[model samples]
Target: MVSFKKLTIRDILFRSRMAYYNRPSLAFVGQEPVTYADMAVIVRNVSGMLNTLGIGKGDKVALIGENSPNWGMAYLAITSMGAVVVPILPDFSGHEMESIINHSEAKVVFVSAKLYGQLDRKNIPGVIAYILINNLQPFDESVTTPTAGMPYETPKAIVNVDYCDCELPRPDEDDLAAIIYTSGTTGRPKGVMLTHKNLVSNVLSTLMIQEVNENDRLLSILPLSHTYECTIGFLIPMATGASVYYLDKPPTPAVLIPAMQAVKPTMLLSVPLVIEKIYKNKIKPELTSSSLKRKLYSFTPTRKLLHRIAAKKLHKTFGGELHFFGIGGAKLSFEAERFLNEGRFPYSIGYGMTETSPLLTGSSPKLVRFRTAGFSIPGQELKLLNPNPHTGEGEIIVRGANVMVGYYKDPELTQTMFIDGWLRTGDLGYIDSDGYVEIRGRSKNMILTASGENIYPEEIEDVINKHEFVLESLVYELRGKLVARVHLNKEALEKYYENLKHSAKDWQHNAEEHTRKVLDEIMNYVNAKVSKFSRLNHIVEQQEPFVKTPTQKIKRFLYKE
Candidate 1:
């Protein structure tokens, strides 16, 4: 019932309050929920405190914290008053956090108690005050006089004891709203400048494709600091009057299973890794455990029927009411996507980056195509640049209301980010005649062969990763030859060896030999599927899982030749 005419975050909140004041708005899992009415009060109170601290329109404020009710409240409070919010990823190292805070020239910082120690006073000299996110209290920086060997009290109360009476500023649609530093896989972080219109426009566009009702409940597992979750998981749901629950801890199996049952979420948004892990570690083994079972799974009719049954169980495991299970952040494994499709799971794929307020193309469950990122979103103009005639592959560029303004304080970087007014997404992909966008890979990650053929490593890695014993794989060029560094499924490998113990005379030697054979088999399997130029010359076993960004994408630069 919220008014769709609202163009800014502040106005959206105001209209949502008018429509659904008594409706549940936000909650931390296992904690009491906050109604829209209650949230309005907290946001207003914190806004007043910020005003008293001299924060106002155009001033930059930094927020670093895990996803929580308070984190959302702090974001709303700052942006509502027309101030710029710089959300730092909590997983960033102390130095990285300090660098961003200083670079943004944030006047005030709202930090979680757990990460308070990461802030260095000397590093962020521009910050005037630090506020604790948990209780919305100010950290005392003034020296306290000792009395009777006990230090005098430092003022902690920042929120007004009485209801906030200060009037909040209304931000223009074009006014700066946030500065989100990108956690890119390579290169220094760049702060993407987003306006009030950029975010609100994306939210409205997303709503056009996906529906969220007051009755719908959302289970938020991604970090709120991430643009994907911030725009879709938090703001879009808020605009629709849907309640969102944040996990108190990481969304591991132990924590997520119980939370799903308790929340009974109707919408679930996540990166591909979450579902891929579940499919590979749990479901795949069950389906391929025995020769008979594997044989049963190979037949199309029988396989589809079996998958449908398994999908029902998967649906129940994810709270049973999930109308939409959105997968984004990265391409989902083919094996997992096949399972979801065969089982008829209500899942869809999305594609975008933080620079686009995080959504440019997404398919609803009914409109999804196999391996495609869906059609271009409404209100966005998407085109392929410098196309290859034969393959139709090119860099995907977009121009729309959701597009970011520019990189903060970096004119040269901003200039290179756009071409002819269209934002260069740096992603290589092609749109089919049917209008489905199929991403090839990051332009920077693409390898050029000696024959001048463009090879997408992601395509090759996908095939490598489908092997049962391979947990994940990174494909790169070494000495002009295609090489894949694969992380084996240690647990699955151990279990396989244990099963072989009874059959082999020397299990250790046989295990090593078997590992080599399987590795060769995996290479053969991948090479058979890919083009000649994409064939792997070697497959090395990675001892550890690759380091990943906040959204679970591997840092490919670290493994680059």
Candidate 2:
């Protein structure tokens, strides 16, 4: 739907300037929004500042910050000025951030106030300047003062610039726009090089899945540094002149609930963990709180009715204006998808990686099914390599305008990332006769049985996650046998032993026995659903949350026993 002379970030920005100059662009919830016209001015000032600091086209400028209006401004200023933007995840450790910054060879760094203390000046000595992203002010250590182990000083830190008449370059479609470093579950971080065509084409392709306009509102809870949120959640909406709201803090219930009510967003982007938590922690418990309710929820018609009621309340809790809810970055639990479809909730699923501009296949709410990842987007061609004759599963390879150039500065690995010119997706899945995609699991995480059967641990873990007391479960191979690690719901565990808690003085041993009993029940339930080779031999308590990426996918490298 987007008409442009060339597929470039500059085209997206200036088109919005001409077509919707007065429209709202970005804002935090309950705050004044920056208009498109205002964005053009701010972007120019920021670009002018970068030029003043001796950074220009082809140079990399790093942005380390939480989501805010200024964060978007910094991104546009860097990319539209023909410089590459290197966005660092705010959740990364100080060491990780330093390594990424130095690796990218950034000329200037824009850091948020909250993360300034974490910036170690000893290692990343390549940075020429540091500007505060909150107020666009250039500062040095001589201007800062430390107090009580905290860096605090009025020190004229906030600089408000009004305008800049500096000239900016028009980038070609092949020009590099961003160098995004992904801390994946595989091994180490890799810098992904995305061109203007790769991103602009992806933003437009994703719009075919779900359209937005100047009137639509989006609440962004995901990190802007991740390609999934940056391309679809931020860039696509901005290209269509939609309003996007950010949360000043983390998206805990206390912050997100109020912000949703205030914005009443028409569209939202999220990973499965957000909805899974609401379903398991909130709706699932209420529907099965009593024997009669559990019986009713088991029946077909009654369960549908109950689901509809719960879905309605859930919709209202999101301010009752949601029309499209996109879940991506990881595979959603099957139990949650069934609830959404049966309940008539407006939910969709997508599949992609940071290497593919983050969107290869996705579905609108109308086309979504129980487990399908839906159809490939426009301008993308998909094929299976060495598919199983029985299951039709294989490595999902793709050729598309949206695929990244390659891993930045890693030609050796990038050469291995493709097979006969088709980019290897590293995902194992099948394309059905109806052209729908179903992703099984990652290839690296696949387990091989002694008899040579392919075992996808995700399938068994899906069943484990449905248990009432299970919050999340991980499946791995331990010495040729499948073992599961489950994080229990403390509230659910307490409620299960309410009688023993009040009546028995010696409750610790009783609690352990009860937990062991539930684990056995869950193991039996999962083994019955899976193939014999895929059955879990043991289910152990994890006791802590799994380490994860910014997108909420578990970091499997740590638990690959």
Considering every candidate listed, which one attains the maximal lDDT?
1
RMSD of each: 3.9, 2.7
Give a tens-digit lDDT track for model 1, residues 351-453: 9999999898998999999889888988899999999999999999999999999999999999999999999999999999888999999999999988899
| Residue 54, candidate 2: C-alpha displacement in angstroms | 1.0
Residue 291, candidate 1: Cα error in Å is 1.4
Error of 1 at 325 (Å): 0.3
The TM-score that candidate 1 achieves is 0.94
Model 2, which residues run further than 4 Å from truth? 145-165, 499-505, 509-511
Q: TM-scores across all candidates?
A: 0.94, 0.96
Candidate models: Cα lDDT each: 0.87, 0.87
Off by more than 4 A, model 1: 1-6, 141-163, 502-517
Q: After superposition, how far is residue 77 of candidate 2 from its true place, in Å?
A: 0.3
Q: Between which residue pairs do clashes occur in model 2? A: none
Give the alpha carbon lDDT tens digit for every residue of 321-385 in model 2. 99999999899998788788889999989999999998999888988867988888988899899
